[model samples]
Target: MENTYYRRIFNGCLFLVPALLLCTKNFSIGAILILLLTATWYLIKEKRNYTLDKIDWMVIIILSAYFIANIPIYLSDMETTRYFKGASRYLFIIPIYFFIRHIVTETTTPRKYLDWGIVVGAVGTIVIAIYQFYVKGMPRVDGYLYSINFGYLSCSLAFLALTLANSSHIKKILWLSFLLCCFATILTLTRGAIFAIPILIIFSVIFQSKQNKCKNIFKTILIMLVFFWGMYAYSAQFKERINFTVTEFHRILSGDVADAESSGGRIQLWYAATQSFIKSPLIGQTYAQREETIRQLYQEGKISDWPISVKRAHAHNQYFEMLASNGVLGIFAIIALIFTPLCFFLKHISKSTHALTGFVFVLGFSIFCLTEVPLEQNLISSFYGFVLAVLINFTRNDLDNIQDSET
Candidate 1:
C-alpha cells in the first residue's frame, strides 16, 4: 500500500513538474496550494535521510557566492527594489533547483521521469509555439513574449527531443516528437538555430559512426535540406536568416572585409560593457545602478551613440554581462555553475552517445547565449535548467540500454 502510494505521488509530481516548467503553460496559486498539500504528504511519508551530491553543493555554493558578492551593490547607491530584484534570482532559482533535484531523486532514476515529461511538454510547447508564430505574428505585449522567442523555444524543444532520441530505447512516439521538434525549429527561422542544429547532427554521426548509421543520416539530411530550402524560399524572414547565416559564415571564414551586422549591435554593446567595466572595475554596478551608469556613460562621451532611451538590462553576452553586473566573484560563480556539470559529464563518458547529445545541446545554447541573454527571463531559466536536469538524467546504463541479440 505504501509502495503504491509512493508511486502514485511520484507519477503525479512527474506530470506537474513539466507543466510548471513550460512556456505556454501556467499553474495558478491554487495549483501551488494543491502541490503543497501533495508534497507535504510525500515529505511526511518519507523515512530515509537525504544525501546531496557534489552537484548540489556546487549549485548552492555558486548561488551563495552570487548573493554574497551582490551585498556591496545593495549597500551602494542602488535602489532597494533593484537590490531585491537582483538578489531574488539566487533565492528563486536555487531552492527551485533543490526542489527539482529532490523530485527527480524520488524516482529510481531521472531518465524516464523527465523523458516522459519532456515528450509531453515539448509537444504542447511546440503546438503553442507554432500557433503563436503562424496565427498571431509579431509585436507582442508588455508582459508577453515576441513570436521570435517562440522560435528560440522551438529550437530548445527540438534539442530536448533530439537528446531523448539519442537513447537506444527511443520509441516511435519519441522519434515523432523529434521530427516535430526539428520542423518547429525550422519554422522559427532562428539563424542561430540553423547554425546550432549541425552540432546535434555531427554528434549524432560521431556517436552512431562505425555502426552503419550514416546512410539513414544522409537521406534524412537530403530530405531536410529540400524542406528547409523550400520553406526558406517561401518566408522572407527565414530567407534572410539563411542569407545572414551564410554571409556571416563566409565573413568569419574569409577574415571579414566588412559587415559586422551578423552579430547586430553586439560590438556596440561590448564597447559599452568594457567602458562600464573600466569605470568601476572592482565592485562593478548593481542592477539598479545600470540605467544611470549607461546614461552617464552616453552623456560623458565615453560610449557614443549608445541608446539612452532604451533600458538596457545586460551586456547582451552572458559572460560579459556577469563580469559587468556581478563582478569578479560573480563571474567565477557563473563559470563554476556552468562548467561543473560539463567537467563531471566529461569524466563519465562511458555512454558516449548520451554525453554527445548533452554536448550538442550545450553547444547550441552557448551559441544562442552569444547573441541573446536567455537567462534574463525566469521561464527560460526554469525551462532550461529543468531540461538540462533531464538531459543529465540520460547518462544511465538502464536508460541507454539496447537489446542484445548476442546475449
Candidate 2:
C-alpha cells in the first residue's frame, strides 16, 4: 500500500519535468532531483535487484565514453576541466534511466503524465516567446534560455506533440500544441530549428501513414504545407531569417567569407577545429591548444575577423567541437550516443509510439548538433537526459507488452 501510494506521487511529479523545463532552469532541475531522490529512497528501502538489459548497458557505456574521452585532456591540463563540465549530465543519465524504470510500473501509464507535460511545455514556450518578442521587442525570443537553445528545444517539443497527436484521443489539443511550439520556434528565428521543420513533417507523415491509408498521407502533407506556408507568409521574422541564411551562404560561396555573418563564422570555426583535429587526432587538442590554433588562424587571416573577435572556445558544430577537443574517441562516443538510441528506437518504431517519439527526438537533436554544440550547455544536457530517460522507459515497457502479448 505504501509503495503504491509513493508510486502515485512519483508519477504525478513526472509532469513537472517537462512542464517546467522551458520556463525555468531551477524548477526542472528540482523536479528531476525530487524524482531521483524519491527513486533512490525506494531502491534502498526495497532492496530489490534491478536488471539492466543490453541496450541499457550500451547507453551507460556510450555516456561514460563521453566523460572518459575528456580525461586525457584534463590530466594534461587541469584548466581544461570546465570544457567537459556538461559531460557530467551524460553520466547522470545512467541513474535517471534506472530510477525511472524502477518507479514506472506496468499498471501505471507514465506517458499520460509526460504527454501532459509536453503540452504544458509547448504552451509555456509560446507564451514566453510571444512576450519576449512582441512586448520586449527583442529581435529573437530566447525565453529562459538563449535564442538557439530555446528555438531547438521548442522544435523538439513541437515534434513530440505531433507524434503524440498520432495516437492521442485529444488530437485537436495535441495538434494545437504542435502549432504553438512551431510558432515559438519561429519567433526565435533559429535557422537550425527552422531547418528541422521538414524533417518533422516527413517523420510525421511516415509514421501517421503507417497507421492509416495512403490516401490520407497526401491530405496530411497538404494541410501541413498550407499551415507552414501561412506561418512563413505571416511571420516577417521567419522570412527574414530564411533570407539571411540564403544571403550568408551566397556570400560564402562567392569567396567573401569576411562579409558573411553566421554561416561564414561557423565555416571559419569549422576550419580551425579541423586543423586542430589533424594535429592531435587520437585524443584531440586540449582547450588551450584549440584556442591557440584559432588565434593563430586569425593572425594568419585564415579565419574571419568576426569569429576571431567573438573568441569562442569550442567549435560551433557539435561534431567539430568533439573532433577538436576530445579527438577520435570523443567523436566516436558522441556518434554512438546518438546512433545507439536511434537504432533502438528505429527498430521498435513500428510497434511503439514511445519509440517513434524517441526516434524523432534523437534525430532532431542530431540535426540541431549540426550547427550548434547543444550538449555543451548544462540546462540543455539535463533536459535531454530527463526526456530521453522518460522516452526510453516507456518504449521498453511498450516493447515488453508487445512481446508478452505475442507469446
Candidate 3:
C-alpha cells in the first residue's frame, strides 16, 4: 500500500511538469525538486539498487557533453553565469531520468500523465496567448516567457499533442489543443516556429498514415491546408510577417543591407560569428572576447553596427552561437545533443507514441535553434531537460520490453 501511494504521488508530480511548464514561472523547478526528494526517499528507505541501462547511459552522456563543453568558460575570468547557468540544466536530465525509471511500473505508466500534461499545457498556452494578443494588445503573445521562447515551446507542445492524438481516446480534444497551440505560435509571429508548422504536419502525416486509410490522410492534409490558408488570409500579423521575410530576403539579395530587416541582421551576425570561429577555432572565445571581436569588426567596417549597438550576446543562430562561444568542441557537443536522442527516437517512432513525441520535440527544437539560441534561456533549457527526460524514460521502457521478449 505504501509503495502504491508513493508511486501515485510521483506520477502526480509528473502530470504537473508539462502542465505548468509554460503557464507558470519556476513551477518545473519546484516539481523537479519534489520528484528528486521523493526519489531520494525511495533510495534511503528501500535500499534498492537502480542501475541505468544502455539507453539511459546514452542520454546521460549526450546531455553531459554540452555541460562539459562549457567548462573552459568557467575556468576563465569572465561573467560565466549566463553561459554556465543554462548549460547546467543539462545535468538535471541525469537525475530526472534515473528517478523516473526507478519509480515507474507496468501498472503506473508515465505516458498518460505526459499526454494529459501536453493537453493541459496546450490549453494553457492558448488561453495565455489569447489574453495577451487579444486582450492586452501586445505585439506578440509571449505567454509567461518572452516571444521567441514561448513561440517555439508552443510549437513543441503542439507536436506532442498531435503525436499522441492518434492513440488517445480524446482525439478531438487533443487535435483542438494542437490547432490552438499552433494558433498561439502564429500569434507570436516567430518565423522559426511558424516555419515548423508545415514540416511538423508532413511528419505527422507520414508517421501516422499507417493508422488511418489513404482517404483520411488526404482529408487531414486538406484540413491543415485550409486552416493555414485561413490563418494567412485572416491574421494580419501572420501575413505581414511572412511577407516581410520575403521582402528582407530580396533586399539582401539586392545588396541593400542597410535597409534590410531581421534576415539581413542575421546574415551580419552569422558573418561575425564565422570570423570569431576562425580567430579561435579550437576552444572558442569567452563572451567578453567575442563581443570585443564584434566591436573591432564594426570599427573596421567588416560588419554592420547593429549587433554592437544592441550588444547582442549570441549569434542568433544556435550553431553560430556555439561556434563563436565554444568553438569546434561546442559544435560536436551540440550535434550529439540533438542527434543522439534523435536517432534513438527515430528507431522506435513507428512503434511508440512516446518515441514519436521525443522525435517531434528534437526536430522542432532544431528548427528553433536555427533562428535563436533557445537553450541560452534558463527556462527553455529546464523545459528541454524535463520533457526529454520523461519521454526518454517511457521510450526506453518500451525498448527494454522489446529486448526482453526477444531474449
lDDT score of residue 266 within candidate 1: 55
Quote the positional error of residue 230 for candidate 1 in Å. 3.1
Against the correct fold, how does model 3 do in TM-score?
A: 0.93
Q: Against the unseen true structure, what C-alpha lDDT does each candidate score?
A: 0.56, 0.80, 0.80
Give candidate 1's whole-model lDDT.
Answer: 0.56
User: What is the Å distance of residue 187 in model 3 from its true position?
Assistant: 1.1
Query: What's model 2's overall lDDT?
Result: 0.80
**Candidate 1 vs candidate 3, lDDT winner:** 3
lDDT of 2 by residue, 51-134 (tens): 878868876875677788888877777764676777887787677677667767655756677778888888888889889999
Listed in order, each prediction's TM-score against the native is 0.74, 0.93, 0.93
Q: Which residue pairs clash within candidate 2?
A: none
State which candidate, 1 or 2, has the greater lDDT: 2
| Model 2 regions lying over 4 Å from their true place | 211-225
At residue 9, candidate 1 shows an lDDT of 52
